[model samples]
Target: MHQQGAQAYQQTANVVASSRERESALLMKAAAGLQKIKDEWPDSYDDLKPALTFNRKLWTIFAASVTREDSPLPHDVRENVANLCIFIMNQTREVLLEPRPEKLEVLVRLNRQIASGLRGM
Candidate 1:
């Protein structure tokens, strides 16, 4: 019984780690997309809409997960995540309205930082 329990725990841990890694990779990809838009702005303005929309969708999913009553995260962490999601939504709206290259920097930085944090965890 003890051995089986240990094995199950290890399996769960591995699954969680894999999920985190995937999430980090996705975040990095999104950030890279934003960076590409910034590098090729004006010509890339059309691309900005899709990239920003993708990120908004991703953050919305995360916000939903973290805010769930059954979420495993601590209350404070969940609250913080919810708040960050709100900020992301607002920022995304601003970027969508203006579609400026400089505005993308904030989204890029946020994605990279969040990805880094996810990777560390």
Candidate 2:
């Protein structure tokens, strides 16, 4: 019984580690996509729509996750994340409408910061 309990705990830990890794990867990917736009700037104005769309979708998923009743994050943390998501959504809309290279910096910074936070976790 003791060995079985140890095995179960190990399995649970592995699953959690795997989930965090995947989350980190996804955040990195989003940050990279934003960075590409930053690198190209006005020269890649055409890419803005798709990049912003992708980011919006990503934030939407995050908002949904954080808002869920089953979310494991502390209440204040969840609230803060949800608020950030709302801000991201609004900012994304502005970027979409204006499509300015300079405007993308905020998005890039936010994604990298979030990715860093995830990695820290």
Candidate 3:
């Protein structure tokens, strides 16, 4: 029975082999958008709300996916991801309240790092 279960898991894993890559790409895309806003500074200020909105929505989806009972990730990993999402939510709130360009650094860094990890880096 155990062997059969292990085999099933392996089969499913292969079926979703590109999920990690897709996740990584999405993260990178979000990071790049945020970075552009950061790099352009006051001139790009008009884009802040939209960029942040995109990132927040992306992270929210990730949070929901990780918390699902059907998620294949280990429990500890899911918990860690949830905690990170919480931090992201808090940081995003701070950015919205203060509206500082420098305040976006952490969000940009976290997104890139998470994306790298997803790529097995």
Candidate 4:
């Protein structure tokens, strides 16, 4: 029954989620993951690398997509997204270097804010 319900939810999500919605979901998921690590602090320090890597990769893809020549986003919007993605990548690198709980704050906030914007919230 659980498996069936999970499948149903996946199907519904695939049908109803637009690109922006999907992006928002991914960002929120990333933010949640990072926040968990932050909340856990030293205990979750070992989880930091994997979380940061996931976020960095996500931002990299977003940067590439926005910067692509055929991207449908407006020039200024694309540029802005690309810039934000770059900052995310850099911040991820810093967190990786220091592994401080406080360093995770900006990443979490940015991801949540970006997700909210994507959802038009």
Candidate 5:
């Protein structure tokens, strides 16, 4: 038998599946918007920033919701997409000030690092 999280993912598959028809597109859209922010924005925060973290259900829902085409691309293509999402978000918070700034290679690197660091903890 699957664990609660896996079982939940299965049960909610229809929620995502049914909503995907309408919100999947929206999630795609939202994901694109986040990508745009991530891509074009800069890290002005310099000192302190928000970090990305995931709660299990939310991660399950987020992972379950999108198809392959979304921006940030739902890393479930590999594993633990929610953790990746949190990592990126936290890294983004680290490098970026987020009133709005342009994207940088540093932001991507920082995001990656933060995600990687998170897995260790």
Candidate 6:
């Protein structure tokens, strides 16, 4: 029984690891696309554009908060749930624009895996 439990854990971890890579790639592309929109029309896109434009810092904070799915956040955290997926994609784009592509890629993967995992239920 113990070995079975351990195997299950290992398998779950492996699944998560692989999923992370897939998620990251999707996020990077989404984020970049959103950023391009914002850059092309700063006046047109609202501050909420996920492509890393006006509210990158704020978006990052929100993303990090959601990433901590188990944490207790401020009352306002729930307010941002309307476009969570879009935001994730935008965040991916934002992170990919950085000089350190490897690190950003990792983040994108993690976000993607999380998003994918939740879609089932």
State which candidate has the highest TM-score.
1
Quality of model 6 by C-alpha lDDT: 0.50
Error of 2 at 12 (Å): 2.2
Q: Candidate 5's residue-wise lDDT over 41-97, tens digit each?
A: 454233123222222223345545543455444355435555565655554555444
Descending-lDDT candidate ranking: 3, 1, 4, 2, 6, 5
* Predicted structure 5: lDDT: 0.44
Better of 3 and 5 by lDDT: 3
RMSD of 5: 12.3
The reply for model 2, stretches above 4 Å from the true place, is none
In candidate 2, the residue pairs with backbone N, CA or C atoms under 3 Å apart (3 or more residues apart, or in different chains) clash, namely: none
Question: What TM-score quantifies how close candidate 2 is to the native fold?
Answer: 0.89
lDDT of 1 by residue, 32-96 (tens): 99999999988998798899988998899989999888999999999988998899899999988
Candidate 4 lDDT over residue span 63-111, tens digit each: 9898889997899999999999889988888887777899999999999
- What would the per-residue lDDT of candidate 3 be over residues 52-91, giving only the tens digit for each residue? 9989999999999999999988999999999999999999
Indicate the TM-score of model 3: 0.86
Ranking by TM-score: 1, 2, 3, 4, 6, 5
Candidates in order have lDDT scores of: 0.91, 0.83, 0.92, 0.89, 0.44, 0.50
Model number with the top lDDT: 3
* Model 1 TM-score on a 0 to 1 scale: 0.96
TM-score of each: 0.96, 0.89, 0.86, 0.84, 0.31, 0.32
